[model samples]
Target: MATRPPSLPTQMKAQFLDAFNTSYALRSVLLPTLTSAHDILIKVDAASYCHTDAVLGAGKMPPNPPSFPHVGCHEFAGTVVSIPPNFSSPSSFKVGDRVGVPGRAFHPCGACFECSSPEGPDADPPGYSVYCPHSKNNGISTDGGFREYAVVDSRQVAPIPEGMSAVDTAVLMCAGVTIYAALKRCGLIPGQRVGIMGCGGGLGHLGVQFAVAMGFKVTGVDNADAPLKLARSVARGATIVDAREQEASEVAVQVGQEDGKKDRGDMGLDAVIILPESQRAFDYGVGLLRNHGKCIVVSFPEQGFHLSSRDLVFRDISVMGSLVGSNKTLREMLEFATKHNVRASVRTLPLSKLNELVVEYHKGEGGKLVIDMALPDEQS
Candidate 1:
């Protein structure tokens, strides 16, 4: 029998959101040349939709003004199909590597002060995925992880660590590393109490787990009356303190700590990770910290919070902003999350279902919604 010709490879598809044009379209786009820059070209087995991505899709996001028709999703985990022959970085792995690029501080000038900074480039203390002064985000300027394939710098790529799956690793780049880095900045010892102001979203849930794994007791606070069950699942043994004036549970800590003068612990509770998408969560987080306590703000809301200097001054509390964990931290974080077996509660949807999911996300509440490759095809 005659051999059939090899099947023609199809163009990759990406979820593009043109905010200025106000359109949500997922279509095939041209792949960039491999010799351009960077080491690995990844086949995205999993790409996660962060609240930041959703906000940007709706034109409510921040950072630089996105060039029109940007590809979507930054949190990524995938298999590396090719590595340039000239690739020389001593990364954990080379081609055929399964890796995660948690998206923060992955700017491309790399040599500039703001890009390199005192903190390690890519990730602080030496991590992956830095948005350098000259760098651009995936799916933002160039195509991002939303496509079937993404190419990133070896400096921005790290092995997904043993014991974690691609589905889980996708968020590890952004949401997972964000909280992990914040906790590290807090510099709390094992047993210090940490308050999570928004305890029930993608970032918040992971923050609770990471905090618990670091040996700090987490008190996850959320405005939702029905968050304990979900928070308990993530925090696992940590307290779920309702932000509302709900009478405290027998094992819960605060009944109305919001009303009371909740100051930082004497030895200090280390840091406070606030993931609320609202302004009040930040203000409330500041109130809960102890003297010299660190209130690390994780999310960016529509309007910045209105904080009082008096509250900051008298308490001797320090408010620090955290990006994500560094490449080194990403490696350490996988071990940390694995040792603790911290799993994210994810709702998987397809690329075609993205719009529906985003609408749902903006309206009601749910766990992390991961974009899987196996969606019902719409182009057919």
Candidate 2:
């Protein structure tokens, strides 16, 4: 017999938002009854901080953390603790079953509009549904995954592939799917060479793997020595370019080829995926691609940059932006992860440790931090 979910516990420890104007503080979770259909309860096992999380935690929001006093993560994986009323039966999952919910819900009604809309800016992110007026987002107005428990929409739940740990899967809920969806948007072909700029950071690492698994020849690009080594290790046989955008513009001129070759297999790059959150990186990605090649962009920066439409039109080079991927794409990502032993290198921390971790993260000291909500504070 399937095990029944434990009674909804009261007084959960949570990362609190004392005010709508401030960041999260460690506090207790309090709420009304969990028996309603609208009260879908989730025991957050793993919640990964996206770069967006950093900004929100800092209170840089048009409208702060959705509802104040809410958890602060969308890219998360957890077990179903309780289902609300309305349509609770035919349990999509039982208690203790491991599953991962993609970070966003684009669909509002039934089917997602992302599948129907022609791909463009006004179109919702690939995984969003028509109901998700606030598409391309999670934890925006809703309580996120930062707390020990969350009440995510049932429509948003998806399964994490069996045999993959929550730590590795957590990163996939957001970054992995974002890149996966981006590459899909580019419609890359087999044997095509793709360059992944910033190829070892939070999103870049996953991009490299996804490109590699999808049968593209991937070139991992980064400036740092440590991340470069990690990228090289994971993408064995793929080239590691020392070229950063700003650094590359100046330095590539200096590496004057011994054979007097300008292309030098670098400019011969077929496509480019810019994951770095900078305009320079976008420019460099465009430059690295072959004439007529595509540059798939995944990062968002404040300052807008420009490119010669003359260059784009004459060369037929395309610059396309990709947001988080669709639900189906996330499923594929997990299947690929399961098949190829793909895993996110995660440093597990306790939910209570978030205050410290967030500070460390901003200082550039952490790598893919995951909050293990179930870990006892004593063990942590």
Candidate 3:
């Protein structure tokens, strides 16, 4: 049986992007209604600003650019306020349940090859529906959680763990899950050495914590002092490298020394996850990997990766790109985070401060910035 929904307002305040590279306009818009049977209305409690938001705003997301006047922000946490009467599937959520939505993909076309079940006994697992091309991307191509209320696909929502605030959950929805998935893609076992490039930024900070919690020996690489301090605070005994002062090769040697490797030739990390959008940072991360080591790219740079043939063929280094996690991975990550007490270090501000937050984001501020949607809008 579905739980009863509380009384909701017919109109609410929301922020919309009128054009590329323009500030978001706050306006009173009709509260979003359930357009699909699987849709659920949420009273947004918290939403976080992400680097992807900036990319989307800059019109850099090509192939399918976002329609103007689109609601921005893809990472959010809120309470379920309503569910469509004909909601599909066995509803795991009830009205008033705290939930967080992964904003990358929504309402995947179930008939596609990526969504179909494996055919043969040894068939590879079906790809994550989050990668389905037919799916809608919240904040990028569709409305997202930058308002007092939001309409989300029921299939994409995850239950917020007990004792976790909506602000923290909002951060986890994107930055947390993306970094965790990247680490998992590294395929390194416990006690293996892993390096996190840009370890003090939003995704980087969480990456450092998750890697340490997963029992890997972590080395945090960053160019700035603020993020380096953040990385050191969260990484415990892990090595912290300042890329501004040391070259990539020098950083690699430092990591090797810290790993207690006496043979200089054998010194290198098992894997390195690139979390910053800087091409230099990406190159530096690749340089830290040992022969046969994997380099995971999570950040998108305008110029793309500049890898030499030597880094690929001679070093036998493998490069992998990771997207935001699937629903299964999100659930597992939340569980692991809850069990290990891993949380994002966040600074909360009201929705009215979003524009300022975006500016701060471009200036390379450290830690996650989340909007407390429950706070009274100053403009209101």
What shift in Å separates residue 334 of candidate 2 from its native position after superposition?
1.0
Q: Candidate 3: how many backbone clashes?
A: 0
Model 2, global lDDT: 0.67
| Candidate 1 residue-wise lDDT, 283-320, digit = tens | 66766665676888877777777777875787677777
Cα distance off (Å), candidate 2, residue 331: 1.3
What is the per-residue lDDT of model 3 for residues 248-344, given as tens digits with 9 covering 90 to 100?
7787777788778886556789999988877888888988887889999988787787888887898888999988887778878888888888887
User: Per-prediction RMSD in angstroms?
Assistant: 5.1, 4.8, 3.0
Error of 3 at 30 (Å): 0.6
Candidate 2 on 1-380: residue-level lDDT in tens? 11124466665777766565465688775632344343356677888887777666556654434556656777888887765434454635545666676657723433445444525443444444523554434566666777777666555666877777777788788877787777777777987777888887777777777788888877777877766766776775566677633454343333324224476334445678888777766776776665677888776665546777965897788888877765556677788778977677677778888876676666543247788776666544
How many clashing residue pairs, candidate 2? 11
Better of 2 and 3 by lDDT: 3
Worst 10 residues of 1 by lDDT: 1-10
True-structure Cα RMSD, model 3: 3.0
* Reference-based lDDT, each prediction: 0.68, 0.67, 0.83
Query: Lowest summed lDDT over 10 consecutive residues: which window, candidate 2?
Result: 250-259
- How does each model score on TM-score? 0.85, 0.83, 0.93
Task: Return the lDDT, model 3, position 172.
Answer: 92
Residue 139's lDDT within candidate 1 is 57
| lDDT, candidate 2, at 367 | 43
In angstroms, the error of model 3 at 162 is 0.4
